[model samples]
Target: MEESKSGTVRAVDRALDILLCFTDTTDLGLTEIAEKTGLHKSTVFRLLASLEAKGFVTRDSSTEKYKLGFRIWELSVNLSQGDDPATILLPEMERLRDILGETISLYIRDGSERIRIQAVQSKHSIRRVAPIGARLPLYVGASSKVLIAFADMNTQENMINDWKEFIDISAYKDQMAGIRKVGYATSVEEREPGVAAVSAPVFNRSHQLVAALSVSGPLNRLTLENMKDHAGLIIESANRMGNMLR
Candidate 1:
């Protein structure tokens, strides 16, 4: 019975190893999994089969490559329903998306980078889309500016003083000034080329900056004139989302 329990634990570990291998890579073949996990091909295949049986993975019949399955998404939705920053913010984001007809995004400050936590894209043909997991420097995008504007003074100074990883020092003061004066920050073709974005900070019940809400699109739709026109609406949506959290 002890040996049986040990074997089961090992099997679970191997299965988890297979899942971990897919984190950074979108898809993987059996051989790639076996090589990356340092497991025998037969063991890898068996573990993958078990994962697939439980709906944790799916193998494409045509490509023979394995990717995450709908069950994973379902579980993610369940887990995020309570704890995700996106879950708390998406409804307001959707409303903003509907009104602006541009992509709306939520970003969280992660270390020295800002990560996209959630987004709603426009149905328009020429929409700007930033993948949910995408990460950017803490000084580039409007979301980053929002984060920086609200960050503790020590962190703000350290990040800006780190000259190696960041350029455009002059923009830091300008960004801070704009974010303070306008209650939001604008990224006119700053982060992604040909894309413009505006971001506002979200405050929690504690009045701490927890996230940022943003609107983005192609240059034609996100021009200076258009951004100025939509700025008030975007700020209002962000304020509503912040109020909801409180």
Candidate 2:
């Protein structure tokens, strides 16, 4: 009986690992999960079968890709939303879009990269938006700057020191300091030639950086200085979004 219990525990551990492999991405195929967990294809298949049976995951027959099921969302909503990232904060993003008439995005840092977990696209014909789930570098754009600006000292130092681009490092550091002081960030043509954005940091209850919330549009509709004009509003909205996380 003890040996049987041990085997069950091992299977449970492997199943949990398979679920964790989907954390960074929206969905994954069996082979992708196997590669991510370093488990054999057959083992991954069996684990996914159990998860699917329990409604912890769902697979699309057309694509054969598995996505987190409604049960996962049910569990997440029970956390008082303190640790929930995207869903609870989406309404604030929608509100910003209504007022700003531009794209509003929420990005969270993943190491040296930032991922857009939520986005409300502009209704205008000429608006801009980084697709949801887009993983962008932390070296450019207003949201990127805001994420780096609010990062821990070691992370900031590591990122800035590792940068090898054309921009001056000292100036970049100074810029980050300015962002920290002002509680917001702006960029024009930093990542793309005709894009502009203003971003503010969103924090969790512990004051740790949770995400960077930004309003973005084309250069003709917004400029670097003009972007700063929305800083107060952006920061306010970001703060409210942060509050919702708690």
Output the number of the TM-score-best candidate. 1
Best by lDDT: 2
TM-score of each: 0.76, 0.69
What would the per-residue lDDT of candidate 1 be over residues 3-69, giving only the tens digit for each residue? Answer: 2355666777778889988756789999999999999999999888989999999999999999998
* Model 1 weakest 10-residue run by lDDT: 1-10
Clashing pairs in 2: none
Question: So what's the TM-score on candidate 2?
Answer: 0.69
| Candidate 1 backbone collisions, by pair | none
Put down candidate 2 lDDT per residue, 119-231, tens digits, no spaces: 99999999896688788889998999999999998999999888857557999999999999999998889888889999999998789899999899999888776787888
TM-score of structure candidate 1: 0.76
